[model samples]
Target: MKKIIIIIITLVLFGSCKKDEPAPIVVPIITSINPIQGNPDTEIAINGSGFSTVVSENIVKFNGVVAKVSSATSSTLIAKVPISSGSGLVEVSTSKGSANGPSFTYIPDIFVGGIESNGSKFVGKYWKNGVAVNVTNGTNNVTIYSIAVSGNDVYLAGYETVGSVKVAKYWKNGIENILSDQSKDAFCYSIAIDGTDVYVAGSEFNGNQYVAKYWKNGISVSLTNGQVSAEAHGIAISDGNVYVTGQEALPAGPLVAKYWKNGIATSLTDGKYDASAWSIVVSGNDIYISGYEDNGVNYARYWKNGLTNALSYNGNNIVDQIDQIVVSGSDVYVAGRQSKTALYWKNGIAVPLTNGSNLSFAHSIFLYGSDIFVAGNEFNGTAKVGKYWKNGSAVNLTNGFFDCSPWGIIVR
Candidate 1:
């Protein structure tokens, strides 16, 4: 009986020992760090998981300077930002592994930047001299598409929900202007500033058809009142001439790429397939627009002085779009995403900017002096963290917390 009882005790002890065996240790993921850092002693925000166990051996550095950790949560560690001794990416190290964050340069306050759309509604924030400005105006019911800055006041164009209807409206300094107060569908997608007057291009529904329209200083002008279902998605003004680009759906079931120079609509496509323009830029009256055309396969393309150029034409690709365009000196820069990769083109030369094959996209581009900045997202199958690319290297901006995306870029 004693031997049998000892055998049972040993069996129970063995079962408890197996349960007590430690599971494999999971290393924390350092998904991102701030790319454009703040001043010295500024708190560095780190995003990822498994950071709570980092105590003594773990260290974070910014451009070779050791960073002092302030506080650490489960997935984030805040550290005092170190002074940059050189230009390089910020790196972090633990006893288990290492990761790199995007790079940053010391500068003044983050400036008055533009706004971008994240799937549904447009959201973002900016600062001047380190003071943050409200971008959303505390509303999630509206979709803001375009923004322009002129001195103190900021102008925005988008659709605001009126009951169940989404009506197009413009905001001057965050005050909503009912320019074309229609109870039907309408949206403003582009805005440009010339001196004190603001110019906006958008689409409005007139009875049964949608027409491309422009608004100047709260007054509306329809470019194609009700001739066809034409929508304007981009707008720019140079030397008092307004340029707008979009697509006009023809009766033959093909949407041709169209642009209006001072209310004169010009078709840029040969009507072979469907085409749409996303962005427009003007360099000395030579209009350039970036978009995509369906030549049996969707290709990233743009029109320069009535000339068509394609950026990608290889894959069984069906959709590629350019979201923004900027001209720096003699160079023309276009930014958008292709095959879920953050893509930028310099004078029509394609460049892919991303840290890895993880899902990344470029939504906006900025030119500060000679440096180029691209803002977008880096996705890891599930979650998408905001990413910023300077030159060609990408920097993780969100640090992998609740997910962040950069829609606009500007330097002050």
Candidate 2:
């Protein structure tokens, strides 16, 4: 009788402890979530109290989108942001109850494209905020010079080596679309997109000389004759009008910087100085173009409505190689190399992206909301490090192992 009574008492004590385990973890009290804003699939830690230690016991939702809780503890839970999740409050559900946390903002995805070398031949690829996706085969030489995002599709313009010639092509969502045949060598420099229409600006060799042209939905339209060598470096579409910027070589051997508005060319610089327009932007009724003019040496200058103005830094006109030009709310932004250091100029004030620690160059500038993004690369004396800047904050995209050159960027 005594042995039976002792065993019964032990069983009652163990059952009581099992019921107490779930009672202590009441409704979760969320203290905070680190990094209030992040892109989709980004891993974020939720710091709080009353969370169950078992991962299956805690459920996290970002704006009603369920997130996978990889791990959990009494005070914290690591959850991944669900794909396609919008901005809203974060909620955590447990067996005890549900708790509402701080609002989680979603950062729109950033897209950038360039070339990365793997010891031997260079191949083309792009990055969505550091996650790389290969667009070209590694056996041949391929390069992506420009990239644009439209809705859910991504378009890239560049060239690929086939036999003895370089063929101009564009990739729509990583699928290749050839723009030029193998009759002559060709090169693609820029790409732009407007609802259902894909435009690519490039140069093609037509027996005698390179012709400035652009392709609309894979159909070619020549902007210049085959008389002189000319190449379209940048393209933009505004208010149903197509604007192409390039340099037309004169008979006297001087290159004249010009832009063609619906096939009608307007010269921005005389043929006396060797100049080329690298980028063009149209805002409202204002037209802006950025490039360099070589008088004695190369000097960065931008033309606003056919009037030339130098890029200013510290109240003085700065000199360097400018690559991309952008206009946001009456402010002009330019990205390039200043004294071998990568920098971007906002309304003529030079904002250096690097501390001159290593050789760097800023090639593309993009504006998102109130944030400024610049894409470029830096040479650290050992390897080329792919980098991009957001509002003057540096973000390394590569691990400095292979060479990376990012020439274009777009954030949406």
Candidate 3:
């Protein structure tokens, strides 16, 4: 009888202990994320369960960098992408546990190349998404004429002063690659890249006169015979053929607009008047050149497959020049200045980008999707400012206190 009573008491004690214990906490489960790719500060939505109702208690991260969480609930939350965050998986944490969502990708940035004056020296720089990166060491005067980006590599073509001589060079991600030997004065005005081969077009002083030349993988090829003054201002590579455009000064005549195909010169003008080509582009088998001809007055013009088409009226007392040309699909775009006003021509139709009140010039043009981007400088009363226009809206890249000029732009 005594043993039976003790056994019942022990069973009753065990039942009471089990009833008083608490349940286990459930871990947070991240299910999905919207808009898998974006730039910094982009808001993203996360859906899951077992999250904290309080925003501060929930933690979010992008590629190991902490993201700012604006709001949070048990099943949903909103967070902003962090700056300098690389592409990686996003994770969310709570008091229960942590869970990872889908991977997020960063957008390819925009780059603009130009010259920045620092006190007494001019430095070569390229702005990546509005952040400035110096290409030169700031010891000598340098100018960056053109910029191109392929994959993750950035290439800039320009010239830097070496002692008393100007040396043509190209910079690959801030590392200088010399194209000229400094034996003579040289200038690199344009650059084009094809796989592993790098081409730069410019002019070199050869004893008597400036000779138009280009360098392929650091090997020099003369486009001119070194007999008269000539210059190669633009370069493009398509279908394994190299094309360059510039002006060739005849013995007693005017500078003629000319283009070279694989080192063979073809005249675009009759050389009866002064003319020069500043930019060139090749699409399919058609070649487009942007330039100006002095027919009593300067007039902006472009040639399509060697057929000249004027962008502005001839002898209209409007000084104009086309500095860059780009083609997208069947549309042709040219950037330049018309009577001190920035403008771009699309299929020979002029679209004014700036008012005629202030002096502005567009030096480079790029197309991304349906958006057009132009880079150049604008005079803000006291100083020239570096800026770029996206779909005709201007965005200043530098403060107006300093003199800066954006000569090239590339959006990826």
Per-residue C-alpha lDDT of model 3 across residues 1-412, encoded as one tens digit per residue: 9999999999999999999898878788888888889877789988888889999999999999899999888999899888657789999888888998889986646899999888778899999999999989789999889998875688999999978899999999999999888898999999999999999999999989999999999999999998989999999999999999999998996999999999999999988888999899899989999988888754778899999888762235355667899998889899988777888889977787888788998999998767799999899997788999999999999898878989999976
Stretches of candidate 1 exceeding 4 Å from the true structure: 1-132, 137-139, 313-319, 380-383, 393-406
All models, RMSD in angstroms: 20.2, 9.3, 8.1
Candidate 2: tens digits of C-alpha lDDT, residues 1-412:
9999999999999999998785444788888998899987688899999899999999899999899999999999999888667789999999889999999999879888998898787788899978998888788788888999875687889999887899999998889999998879999999999999999999999999999999999999999988999999999999999999999999888999999999999999988888999899999999999988887644788889998877744453446678999998789998988766899877767898888788898999998878899999999888889889999888888888888999899986
Task: For each candidate in the order shown, give its overall lDDT on alpha carbons.
Answer: 0.71, 0.89, 0.89
Segments in model 3 whose C-alpha atoms lie over 4 Å from true places = 1-30, 39-108, 313-317
Q: What is the TM-score of each candidate against the true structure?
A: 0.66, 0.76, 0.76
- Consecutive 10-residue window with the lowest summed lDDT within model 2: 311-320
- What is the Å distance of residue 121 in model 1 from its true position? 7.7
lDDT of candidate 1 over 1-412, digit per residue (tens): 9999999999999999999999876565777775455765567678876665545555877778787887777677787666433345666677667777677555522233333344555454443433545556535556656656664566667766666676887777767777667677888888888998888888888878888888888788888867678889899988888899988888777888889988998998877898888789898757888887888755677788889877762343543557888887678888977666678889867778864478777877877656787877787666676666778876665455444555555543
How much does candidate 3 score in TM-score? 0.76
